[model samples]
Target: MGFFKQVFKSVFKNIIDLSRPIFTFENNELKFKINSEYYYTFALNNYETKTRHDSYILEAYTINSDNLFVEYVHVDNDVTWNGLASSFFVNLFKEKLPINSMKIIEKKEFEHYEFITYKINDEFTLNFIYIYEINKDNFIIEKNAELYINLLQSFQKDYKYKFDKNQDLEFDINISIVKENALNGYFNLSN
Candidate 1:
């Protein structure tokens, strides 16, 4: 019975390992480690200060890749700073990222939270970073597009991205989350 149990566990572990993405590169290049954490509010109704923290870990490979795979390790780093949540999110634009380094692909709002997609280049290393906040209820999509276009123009002037004048810019970003109730769902029995 114990041998059977061990075999089952091994098979489960193998399955989980296979489910995770694998990384491989052909060129020898320096990889940059990206780490960022942000805590904001979701309760825009009552206007009370509430916060949730999110942390991301990103590994970059040489040569351009289509998507960025980041791991979420810590959640809710904003709980303690609840009293200042509103002001914190409102004053976010003070942060600015260097232009021409990355492209702004898309900005999305989910459940009253806003997220922006930025293009990543394998050649340009991380220099500066930006953190922008948006009010999902009031943030106009057209404004986001304007912001992206402006940023792209700056990038062209600043870095002169190596591309033909007619080439279209492209990149990918993804978001992953573990819900509050399913913190340990991976170990839970599924039906």
Candidate 2:
């Protein structure tokens, strides 16, 4: 009976493993494996900032020659912060983070939130994103045709990523949570 139980557990674990995606990084290349198939992918850390006790990071990546752009940002090593992305600054010359390095593919928005998923096909898909605080004039404008990726950081475990190889073909940005917030948030309300 014990032998039968062990076999059952092993089979169950194997089944679970088969359904999961395997990510491999070797020879400076990123490969994603799903269901026995492998895909070649390229990722870039784009931009990052660190200042003793204040900083933020910006990142973007695509897969297998696709024009998808997945971005994630961290403020003081915390995975959070989004403001209203307005089109008013579309033609502004001031380049700000994130939006400057994207090509508009699809965009979605809420009252105080705006999500833009871009595709870098050519110059036509190029667009701008201007983020500003709610009901405030303080704005961060970004838009550049040639925002190259420079410094890179290893992937942290606190991100949300979805990689699929099925026929449906869905692409999305992965948002990972930081190991911990800086000083646990000014008011001590976070971990």
* Highest-lDDT candidate: 2
Q: Rate the local accuracy (lDDT) of all candidates.
A: 0.28, 0.31
User: Candidate 1 on 34-125: residue-level lDDT in tens?
Assistant: 11222211111111111223232122111222222222222232323322322332222122222334554444333323444444443322
* Model 2 root-mean-square deviation: 13.9
Looking at model 1, the pairs that clash are 53-76, 53-77, 100-155, 103-119
Candidate 2: stretches off by over 4 Å? 1-24, 33-103, 106-191
Clashes per candidate (backbone, < 3 Å): 4, 8
Q: TM-scores of all models?
A: 0.19, 0.26
- The C-alpha stretches of model 1 lying farther than 4 A from their native spots are 1-3, 10-90, 95-105, 109-191
TM-score of 2: 0.26
lDDT tens per residue, model 2, 1-191: 99999999999888876654343334534343323333435443433322222234332222222323322222333433332224323322123223334455545333323434344333223322222222221112122211111101122224222212123333232221221225323112124
Worst 10 residues of 2 by lDDT: 145-154
